[model samples]
Target: MELQTLYNEYLNIKFKRGLPPVRTKPFEYGLYADDSAGLFLTDHPEETFTNWMYELIPRDPHYISAPDWQPVLADVFQQMDIYDELVLYYLLFTLNTTLSVNSHNAYSTMNDFMKNYSFLQLSHLSEITRLNEEQKHQVRDFFFFYYLYAHPVNEETLYACSFDGQNLVHTKTDIPLERYFTAFHDHYSTNIKEYTEQIAIAPHDIQACKHLTLQLLQCIEGKLAKLNMPEEKGLEAVLRLINDVDQMLQLHDNNKPALFEMMKNFLKEARSTPYRDHCFTTLLQNYASYILFFRFDEIHALVEYFEDTPEWCRTIINKIFMDTIFMERILRQKRIDITTYPNVTQFFEDEAKRIYL
Candidate 1:
């Protein structure tokens, strides 16, 4: 009733494909037959079963040559408790010493030999899925750590390790140009007003002020057509703007004063830059309108900010104008015509629902 003898018998029963005579005890024979079939088709059928034998059976240290057992060992080790600190230390030492001191061909030969056993090892692991929770956890942890050590530089392997640990993956992609601009405009127009109001009433609320600054940037982005800008330029502009705002927010103690000073310098520089006159003009109009509506007291503050430069501010204002005008043209071109409406509010409500919902 040795474990190896039992495994060999089970393997023979399963892989040989012919059942022995039906015994008087039909139920026992049926159960054995079922178990045999299960083992043969199990994940890593060869490795799992062989490892099970190795673990359960007491044998000479070199009873099974390393070459003969290396493949199954490597495969099973991944799913083993051999990652325990003590075990890991020993395993690392063994792997390093064996490969380093051995002949140059030793590593390749070992790898080639291991590759040939992959199918069996995989089958063996699959067969053990029916094991209890504790057993399964041990198997999974072993395999994970094993693969981690083996393929340390492989991105996919690293991803698998993190996935196993965190159970989540994140992906990022560029927003479509047209939709990006529209979304930016919508968000800016809605949120920037609220943000500007916060700045006027409670400027000390650093977080809110920071959020508002970000919303303004988002608004500016919405106004600018990303498609018109070179990809690198667009990316660079966004990154620089965002980073500046973020850094300003992080320096909360001096942020409000710093922000005001920065805005002043920006306006001054804008006014002096003839080449950027159009962009300045557009920004100025938006600022003027925004100032008049929400932060009238800050008008003088803004004027002071812009006093040093005339031409650069004019360019910025012109750019803002172009954006607004371009957007207006696009809207007019794409406007939905409604010849008849009983009530203006109801008409708008329906139109809004159609477009948004």
Candidate 2:
């Protein structure tokens, strides 16, 4: 098996060099640590095996695919001088990004590996591989998959391959907006209102609007349920988690007001949940997100009375400072007093000085 060959190759290298046995994982959450034991792992030890240990990564069932194994084994190539471009690329080409983000970043991880070594450290990829015509086509197609076919991909994403003479050089191609947004809902464009405004300049596509509605629906249906379990992760984590959810919920649908009201009602139940001091900061910021999107019915859902706090000055006010035009109108129409965060007024004053001064 390929895993056996890779493992054997590692053992041969270690045996030839007479390095100490690897110490491996007592605890490994994601990836391996290079200097976890110490510089002595990379730096040679005394003839006795006293102060030397390295982690034997890629052991047992921990690594199944290139996304799992390539990152863990990359240090092997870098630390030891066994360069295998074909081996690395073969593993990469076998994987797809639809599974997890680790698959998505395989190219960027390869880029980081390439960025470390200069042309001096590497063999001329052409001389090393010596591929026939058909094999060369395989490499070219891999480029298309790595860039265009990956998740969170956009015009900004770079096409990449490792074995060509170009090796690290890659290209970025422009893609149409609606086609892009429809394929990937909230990956590239977070603020749906921004794209909604752009429809005037390039009118025809309402896919961005449609996608935003879908994203909100999916988040509420699937993701929000996981976070609301205050018993699982505690209330501080809940507040922080929900605030993270706040950033992604921007959308353009006629039903947005109703949907936001539903979300506000969900968060409203948290008042009785156990919480620490700054849980209210996320609550206020969540309300600010609603106000920014012009969803105002449950603007006072968290509390009937609003009071000023220094933390409010730092977070909610500072966040909506640029969008004060929308937020101030929401507060004013809701009969919420201006004293809740005076910095909203001060933000405009600072802007006034920057513009007219």
My TM-score estimates for the predictions, one after another, are 0.18, 0.23
- Give the best candidate by lDDT: 2
In candidate 1, stretches whose alpha carbon ends up further than 4 angstroms from where it belongs are 1-257, 260-299, 316-322, 325-357
Off by over 4 Å in 2: 1-28, 31-153, 156-285, 296-311, 319-343, 347-357
Evaluated with TM-score, which candidate comes out highest? 2
User: Pairing residues by index, what is the TM-score of model 1?
Assistant: 0.18
- Model 2, 1-357: lDDT tens digits are 121232222322322323333432211112114311211111222211111111211233324343333333233233311123222222222221111112214455433212211110111112222345454344334323333332223332223322233223222112222222243333213443454432221111123233333332222222122223122233443343343443323321334444444434444554442133224333443345333334443333312222233333333344343322334434554575555533343433455335322
Please, what are the lDDT tens digits per residue for candidate 1 over residues 1-357?
122232233323433424353221101112232332222112223322112112222122334454223211333233322222123323222222211111125444323222211211222332232345454344334333333333232342233322222121111112222232233224334454454622222222222222322332222222211111111221343223222322323332244345445444555543343213322232333233222222334434433444455444333333332322222222233362322321211222332435422
lDDT of 1: 0.29
- Residue 300 in model 1: shift from native, Å? 3.5
For each candidate in turn, give its C-alpha RMSD to the true structure in angstroms.
33.3, 23.2
On a 0 to 100 scale, what is the lDDT of residue 231 in model 2?
21
